[model samples]
Target: KATVDFQPNYDGSQEEPTVLPSAFPNFLVNGGTGIAVGLATNLAPHNLGEVIDGICAQIDNPEITLPELMQLIKGPDFPVSCEIRGIRGIEEYFRTGRGSMRLRGKVEIEENENGKSLIVIREVPYGVNRAVLQERIAELVNEKILTGISGMRDLSDEETRIEIELKRDARPQVVVAQLFKLTSLETSFSVNMLAIHQNRPKQFSLKEAIDAYIEHRRDVIIRRTRFLLGKAEERAELLEAFLLALGHLDDFIKIIRDSKNRDEARERLGSYKFSTATAEKLGILIRSQAAVQGDRYVFSERQVNAILELRLYQLTGMEQDKVKGEYDGILIDIKDLLDILAREVRVLTIIKDELRVIRDKYATPRKCPILAEAGEIAMEDLIANDAMIVTLSHRGYVKRTPASEYRLQGRGGKGLKGMETRATGKDAPDDFIEHLFSVQAHDYLLFFTNTGRVYVERVFELPEGSRTAMGRSIKNVLDLKPEEKIAAMLRLERSTDENGHDNTFREGAGYVFFATRSGKVKKTSLNDFRNYRKAGLTAINLEEGNDLIGVNLTSGEDEIVLVTRDGMSIKFTEGVYKKPQGELAEGEEPVEEDSGEEDSADEEGRPQIRPQGRATAGVTGIRLRKDDYVVGMAIASEETMLLVASENGLGKRTSFSSYRALRRGGLGVKTLNVTDKTGKVVNAVAVTEQDELMLMTSTGQSIRIRVSEIRETGRVAQGVKLLTLKEGEKLQDISLVIPDGEDSPGDDTSVDASEGESGSVTEETTE
Candidate 1:
């Protein structure tokens, strides 16, 4: 260690060097952490070879910028193999010596031969204790804050490896995301590149640190060169004196013999004369070419003392030749040393060559992998974008399958098995598929319950399965109150803003029209319930015995049709509201209805009413009998046909023109003839000629028929047999499945039919 300065020991008996002169930048190579009086420092370690290479580069070009130097240095290299996200933090640290970066453990999902997957964490960030990390993860799992982990174990031995076993059917990626959010698997590293330079502590940028190392190496080269030069000059002078005596051997022997003591002999040799050959060589040997000083060889005191102390064994002829050769080599060395002291470029060259050697011997490959773009993975990234067939069973079970599972078949063909497994619930039900439609997984689904509450869930959150697999019960997903069930489900696509946002459309821009089982109807803006809570949000204020049954999205210009179980259907144009209706502006009292303009009916002789707000009980949508309640609701247009089906497998299609437009609170049309031969109306849907219908029975049998094959007739005509049920079976529910990329058929119009008309019915058979 080169002593910068000395300090007394504890008892003042010894001195110690304050700092050692390091050959390389120790602060940057093996980074340090320390806490001083009011400040602290944390520097990340770097690769040894990279540090050496950077020093050499700075020595070659002192004016290089930080960014240019960074190209050679890259970024910090740690011992543990982890991931460092992005270059922004590293660049800032190198430029100003202070910044922070995100570091994540290197993790991979491995699957064994049995198809069981394990989350394996192979490495962690620098300075992180593996035992502490394992403990933290276990604690979170025990607390149930992090889920899907069945068990966790610390398998670290020679290398760090933590294995997290997942339960069967658990989503691995989703669990990993949760782990990152809840545990210390991902963390940040703060960088503070502070060091002592020129006897003072100071912050150093990357380029400045490299420059400091270069200066230290330069000083070492100069001091060493000067010391060697001094020794070489002294040795050269003594060699010249000895060579002169050898050339005049006869005089040298006589002088030594005649002298009384060694001092007298040394004096005699110093004044001895030599031949012209030795004189010429002496002039060239001394740095200054002074003449031989009047035929006498003059030596300094150092050379005289050296000759007096010479041993007898070193006085042989072979030894004399060896001394002559050493003298010549010393002359060359002295000249080169002088050159090094005189030129700064030569010193720099020496520093570069030595650094290169160190780099070649010690450099290693990078351990941390830096990403270009870094941030937390978003929820959208984990969801696959595909058109999925979402099926909701009558028994409250739900699942999603790819749309490719079902192929188009001719009219009246036996439908492909929609759901192959049975669902168990109260009464051991067969769980016929009640609702089946295609929508993208990213879309939002609003589940309107019979209790007038709405629950929102993303399509992707539903359990995904194959066509034959029975899915999880919906009760596990939604927190439904006692005896509550989803009555109607609506799919809301993403709104357009280039970047999609849900329901960004303004209030009153669109409407969600609601219809209840007690023939109550209401219209509320689509944006009114956008901010729903997990438990659910109030969709409408229901009366004591009424429950929500039908919900549809409309632009406020379309026509609506409501059908009852007793074969009654009503069609009305969506009404517009003028005055304040529900929960009036803050503290206003409720106003009594005027009923003044002499209440009158519309052109079709049906009662007309103004629209009301969401909180108010709805106006009458249809007048129903005591034993009847609305069974189906749809938006109708002229080009579309209404497919009505009964419980005993009788079905028919009547053109939407067959229904006449009425005002709100009208129940004045027959959609199908309900009799002993044909049971009560089970389902009714507005469909296009190109669409297909799925008919399900109480016995778990289903059939697909095209809308064009069902003979279209007037609303009063009895329908034909659509499905051949067994002796004890009846139709349970029916759904209209639209093919992809087909425009909805029809123009807005309505037609009315007379009641009590009998018609012939034929039976259609399908295996």
Candidate 2:
């Protein structure tokens, strides 16, 4: 068992010091375990800042409810990611002031292209050994301790990937549901409340232990504060008494100065009789004859000097001045004392307020009295019937009966004596049984057989709505305060005969059920139907007469439904006929006959086509060619001659005299170019604004010239003439020729000479 102790002390200075001078308790955030006696506690640590704020909030206002605290605290701050179960109990424990920390994993869902989704876990809880945890899960599956987990095909130290493939027609949400329901990606911790004391043999909850310590400390502080206040008051009183004594001395001196002679002064002072010592000191100063006068007791210089020399207790005994000064100093000291007292009082007041809040916030309400018909049984009769009764209180105690008292009658009955015989010899078996039955601040009751089969009727007070249990009025039990119900229940019973060995009555199987408001019971089971795979009722068969429209299948459970366009339905089981892919058949097209003959030429000599041609392409003089280089040309001359050329002799030419003529011709040119090879000029007059020239060489090379940059050369070729043909002139078998003085055309400058001819140049240039 691990123990943590926080002992604080003051060094008479202002600072309080921590006693445990080693490692602090920060590891608790990650998760840790401790045990004391029969109880043990596990801590799942979270974020430090969050934990501190939670503690401070409780300190500020102890009455804050657990739900409210959870809102402020949010979830655990785990280093690794994980999920926490049983969080509903967390608040109750904290209010009871006995909760451990928790770390949870982070999980999210992502969608793939197929409309299928996968659950992705990005983090795990702290202190969970990656490799070992995975290995343990694998072992559990292999050993059949866990089942219905199919997709754990592989696992690494850090991650486990599950199988997520879905059928072609399957819904994606169903697959996601299965992944969460069937996997070990989620887990929980059950807190086993525990604490230890060096002087005691028992364990305690954290709240009980801390409350005891705080109360003890509060008492100590109150006692110390009262003692300090008493000391301060005593010193103040002594100073006030000294101040009064000083006032009497001042009165005696005034009387002596008014006397006429020493004799007169003596007689006057006697009327106000001072202390003997004070009277003597006054007489000696007044009796000096030379200083004495008739009305004011005045004397000569020598007489006054002699009077001043008279010893007044060596001048240190002139106590009036000393007392007066001391009184003023003491008054200042008292003021400081009062200030300290005021601050201490404020601190106590605050402490009281905080304590009151804590009491109101976390305190459990008294149990509501239940009005069930009382029943009893004799100890001997109960033992004869092999029955055991248990009771619990708000305090923590448990007791039960020894198995030896039961009369065994079944095949597996080696009798209650068997359990007693197997019991460890540490103490009498009966003592353990008695301890189990002794109630000590526990909130539940249990009744069972020696073999550990719980008698549900004997334990739970059935509500009026529970028809199965005789419809007993259990509303009072259900309404019992939060602190009244037990946290959990356990039972001991004889094992089944599956082993096929000698019949020996050991502890049998037990089941735990959670009570719900609707009178429904939830339980943990080895055969869980909630998981997608184990629930065998998958498909609902909806025939033509069946009324069910939709069937909700459990996750990972496949269902097939057959339906006609007219809405008849039928469901198929997994073993039944598989779904067949549906297809459509081809059909013939239909046509409509005209009601009357088509119209002839109208009075204006224009023919009109009937609606019969509506489905046909209506354009004229244009055809859809597989490969035509569509080009738009701007006219440079009054009429431009155009050529169309392509590979494999797919070429033709048409002539147009003007832009209007070209539009009417609707020529489809095969190629257009903006630049020529060797970047030289040829037939520059033919170039026009934005006109693209196309030329093809014999070796299949193509060149383009931009007509906008043309500079006309005033020359023409004789053999291969460059002529400016106009007004729809068309030429064939013509080639480009360079001037005589110019350099001979190289391979790079030679025209393709494939198309019929090239046009001539005009002696015109644009600025």
The stretch of ten residues in a row with the least summed lDDT in candidate 2 is: 657-666
lDDT of 1 by residue, 531-616 (tens): 76657888888877887777888777777888899888877777542233344322122332332224323335332544455566
Candidate 1 Cα errors over 4 Å, as ranges: 1-386, 420-425, 498-505, 576-613, 741-767
Backbone clash count, each prediction separately: 7, 50
Taking all chains together, the TM-score of candidate 2 against the true structure is 0.26
Residue 109 of model 1 has an lDDT of: 73
Model 2 collision count:
50
